[model samples]
Target: MAILRRQFAAALAVTGLGVGLAGCAVSQDRAGSTPVGVADSLYWNGPILTMNDAQPQVEAVAVRAGRIVAAGTRADVARWQGSTTQVVDLQGRTLIPGFVDPHSHLGGVGLQAIAANLLPPPDGPNTGIAQLQETLRRYINTSPDVRELQVAFGFGYDDSQLSERRHPTRDELDAVSTTLPIVAIHQSGHFAALNSKALERAGITAQTPDPQGGVIRRRAGSREPDGVLEENAYFGALQHLMPRLTVEQSVGWLEKSQALYLQFGYTTVQDGRADPGGVDTAIAAAKMGKLKVDVVSYPDILTMGEGRFMQGPYYSRNYQQHFRIGGVKLTLDGSPQGKTAWLTQPYLQPPAGQPASYAGYGVMSNAQATAQIEKAFANNWQILVHANGDAAIDQMIQGVQAARARYDSAGTLQDRRPVLIHGQTLRRDQVDKIKALGIFPSLFPMHTYYWGDWHRSSVLGDPRAQNISPTGWVLAQGMRFTTHHDAPVVLPSSIRVLDATVNRTTRSGQVLGPEHRVSPWIALQAMTLWPAWQHFEAEHKGSIEVGKLADLVVLSGNPLTVPHAQLIDLKVLQTIKEGVVVYQAP
Candidate 1:
């Protein structure tokens, strides 16, 4: 999707590009070019979305060093053009501020890339076990590089879709690989199906009891555990059997992931959960100056041990240009669709014949979760908790409130904007409380499209299902919000999330909840500016204005002008960060 010249012309007029540039250039040139010791970079002939209300549009932007020097018309920036300056002509493309993904698991995404690739369930109808097995066989056989540990991904096996309406058991996975261990991660990332060998390798057996905050599905007649592992149980068991990648290997995968982010027009990414190794890898990349995209690493608070270096004022000034230790991430609950998320009320319907009374709750105890939050708060670290269900949200709110009360009494409550990531199923009453606490909600609205149908039937039922993201409701409550794809959890594409937000259409082409749908403008802000605010980088990034970082994405069409469904198809022509062209389409 090449940028069309017509779009630029429209933006040029709105931005007063020609007039502003001509005036600025004449004024600057008359004053003589004094060596300011700062190099200049200029981008011209493009439609620029400033994201700033005072000056909403611009035709060109000039950058000095790494900050925007001026934003106006092509002529206005021409005066800054010197022999040492780097100039890029966007040729009438639509340029908007670079996207900031508020929530993403960078290491998980890299791991998925290293794992097997399986075909997703067919678009129209469900492919039964026989068909699915054949497809899996083909993928395994064709991809010879996928060795004995034949772990394949991308299986969207909803219960209703299957004739048996049950999770594929260890016996079924044995058909694929007996000697080698195999694990098929569900789309929701909350559940995973492991083969018998894989389970045995992790020392899980028929006598093994379910761990707290996690479940191991068991057969009805026998005490033998089914292959299905839910929540932390799945992660815990899998962590044992999974092969560990070396630091170099991890860095390679991260580099590949960063390239993909750049292709999608992201300049900054918040690593939603970072293990110690992952944090080390990020630091290594930053130190070597190999990181192309800006990174904010949020270390996983769950793994912190006593007397260990936990929270950080650990700033590397040399790497500060592209990397920062932003905060700590704590996952309080799992996904709602997976039925593992702790909710205030029981699920609408139990899985198949299971009694409604048997619906599960969140994995972590309230005390344990609260302690983690309090410790992070005490250490002056920003906290981002992943809480999806209303019950989980309630717990999170309680934790935040308690922490605030404790800190305030000691006169140590500096305004820390602790965020609740994926507050998807929050209750109406909790909305005001979130605003009052200054706790930002990073809404995962993309779920409305990906699992809307499943949610309508199995998970949330009808009433609460429609209120999933509640973008409109959140706005009405005056709560700040940011939206994300949670990359690798899904593909990291803001366009897809925007399409889902505006269109509200399911994979089956049905619009689920029209009431919760937000306008294009609001959706755009949630992806761009709101995310910057969540990360406390609003002052430097998020918007296009003087003194801000020059990070922008040039597109083929104005997202506002395009039809809702067409937003996903809009092409990115170029991506610029710190006034340098980071990516450009041929």
Candidate 2:
């Protein structure tokens, strides 16, 4: 490897491609480049998308020691060709920048891997309470060491998609396993339905007081726990029984999630929120050299309280040791599909006990939110605020304004790269406010494909549903924004994300937000360059440049050239992070 680096450096010098390191100088163009006898890897691809505008396309790229040394036509990069160079001919495949998933939950990903697949159609076939019960039983019977676990756990149950059109009750889960505790979380991850055993083991009962921003659904006509928990209450109950979403719990599962993300061409994954245990696990992994793809976590301010979490070596501009706490996360509202998003307008269909005009509630008061944002800003921490509804977005904008007032000494908001997560029901004016506030909306366009029909007929009511992510509007402002799968809300598939973004097609094949659909090129930017910019790592990882790390993805088909309907058909042939191939298709 050492000798290979020296040769790669020498070739880079001769090619006038040296960015920082020094060596030899030969020709400025590929025609006159020298053929050195060394290179770690040489990919003579048909189309290498160097996101760099100056060189939008390249025929080949060469890497040494995880950094791009040269990128040009096959002949130019061939100059760097050496006896040891591992040459690869990307046969008509499209190679672009590796995806940077700016907003996702690594812990959630791990959990999804470890738990049972109780998700409804698309991710799983269980769409009814009976199927959910059967799935739980199957998971328990199949778990390798189920007896050793504290309890049986299943995840990804969606009330909206279930044939019953509602969440399962405690008694229903009890039928699966009455002797052992059982808990299945909703697809939203903000709610859960526990069996009677689980509720008893978790000490959740009719007498348990609801946490400030949560609810415990009660049995009718009496104060008895119904096993349904919402928001903080659900998470709180889960903390005791399921354990916090820590890396410790994710032992083998973390790697599974990494491989899954890599399969989707994600070279960089974000853990959007982490508790104290997750923080420890990440730090330990970083110290032990266990992280593969870069995992950027934003410890939840609400979860670990303030400053008590994965207290970083503060922060790093790079993915140090494969892990780092890039920022702080705050959840101001719940999921939109779950009907818990704090919307200004009521849901088209309210919950059982709520009035027809029932909009969801906020987790914190305006003052509390402002203070948290101000505190994070004062400490110079990047902020990621989850706001799914228009009301939630409004709250975030106000909080950001307040934080700016308190921290902006020059009377201008610094480029802190604060991210407004979800932005599902944001209005046009709220978007303008987000831009003016200098916030990046890491919106979830996946909703279009996963719940567009649901949103139209149930949640947002027609027109509002059509504009869930509003990608086109963000593009209209000539400002860059990022999009995400928001897994484990939806499964993490960048192709699906790209497809939903470019198509906005619903399950019923209706175009949800035709006006909000963005072009494939713009959608790709959101997944790559825009997300890298959002995470403050654009200088190093966003694009394929001479100095940038050779983080690339080879797709089975070119997303840009593919027909709009066939975008999701694109597959990940390979994923390379820092010049190292982390995953490859079989």
Candidate 3:
């Protein structure tokens, strides 16, 4: 440490840093530490876009002990340059604060990785059941883990993309292997299909009554289970199917997920809807010192009990070595693209089993959900409810209003920063209510890029479909909102998130809503600064300003100056967390 300090001093003198360069070596206590001294590192010579509106841009940033000490023109921050200070030459590249994706499933990413890939273009090429089966068979044949488990587990099956234009049936999956239990989860993560053998294991039978808030799609006429499960039924089935992963195994999966997130320039990620077991695994990983990226988890309000929610030791908002239990995650309904979200208007084209008037069903009764919300608030936990359907949003609105009235009727609203997750089908009036109530919205607008056409033609007719995420509506009200890719539901691609937010373009080269499109700068803010604010970490994160954590990323090109089409092609050149490089492109 002494030698390093000497080097820092000598380097500062040699670099001709003006004014008291030697004084930088004298560290001070809390009351009076010279803010702009010889920095441990400096990044200069590029477009440094700080999301801070005060000093929107800076040429150089100096870091001391993992916190920014200087951010200004090259000459202004040059005094921090020293021999020991690692200087990073940006070489005309672009630098912004590291992307903060508030609504993702980092832990789920590992689970998704272990399963067979059944997604459509860009990730996998399974456009039909044949390709899906091929991919499953390939995973079974190649993955020794699958062979040992004696079950074929796959995820990311999208009926919307299927050539058959429907979910694969049990008989089709039985074709994979009649003896082995097979389960293929839908891309929405709200549904799953089980083969005959898997169904028998989960005890879903012809006589078994449909669980409340969930469905077991039956075969043509009779009550024979068709093996497809939605909402709570899917979660119930998964409770039976998911194996007991060891702590080490869970850590390995988290590490794998972290590596992928780091590549995408994610310093902070989320495990949005961690079940109790998932939360345990995350805590175990944190205690063992295995976490590399910050993970804020929200255990499902339904799956976990009040006792657990009230007494769980992992339920703190503070960073406990890269892990924190943000709050409780409640799912009010299913995905809009799956034609299962509880919408006010009927779906343009309902799925096979439902009537034309079928709008979707809530995953829980209003009484049950409101009870959970009341309990969560009673315990002082921040609530981030998942309400993709407009009706579900209504549930959230009523529930939150009642909770606030019951608990803090003095107009405080608990100051909990209650969140409305997804809100894909959120209405404009709800936008006003959300703003008035001080609820934060972490919206999923990538639906425009991934499922816009499907939403327009089948899930929701044109008018409603065009407003899926409605980020622009929130902006119009002068309310702040954040955007996300909801990793595992989709690959948490940062550029793709930004691109979709900025363009609102569907895959078919059509703009879903031109007015809904935000600027590239606003899109960047959604990913960086705004999400930080949503998570209540804006002070230390969100911007490249002095005294904040030097968590930043360098891109191959500036997102602000890029053409819309080329935004998706931009690469993350380097990712720095607390001024230390964590990832760099090959």
Clash numbers, per candidate: 4, 4, 1
Candidate 1 local Cα displacement, residue 490, angstroms: 0.8
Model 1 is weakest, by summed lDDT over 10 consecutive residues, at 22-31
Cα displacement (Å) at residue 475, model 1: 1.2
Candidate 1, residue 316: Cα displacement in angstroms equals 7.7
Candidate 3 lDDT over 226-278, as tens digits, reads 87888878888877777777778777877888888999999888888787777
Output the TM-score of candidate 3: 0.93
Off by over 4 Å in 1: 1-40, 84-86, 119-135, 142-145, 148-166, 307-321, 409-413
Give the top-scoring candidate (lDDT).
Answer: 3
What lDDT, from 0 to 1, does candidate 3 have? Answer: 0.83
- Give the backbone clash total of model 2: 4
Please give each candidate's TM-score: 0.88, 0.92, 0.93
Quality of model 1 by C-alpha lDDT: 0.73
**Candidate 2: lDDT over CA atoms?**
0.81
Give each model's whole-structure lDDT: 0.73, 0.81, 0.83
In candidate 2, stretches whose alpha carbon ends up further than 4 angstroms from where it belongs are 1-33, 243-249, 305-311
Q: Write one digit per residue (lDDT tens) for candidate 2, span 265-302.
A: 89899988787777677677777777778988898887
- State the displacement of the C-alpha of residue 581, model 1, in Å, after optimal TM-score superposition: 2.8
| Candidate 3 C-alpha error for residue 455, in Å | 0.6
Worst 10 residues of 2 by lDDT: 16-25
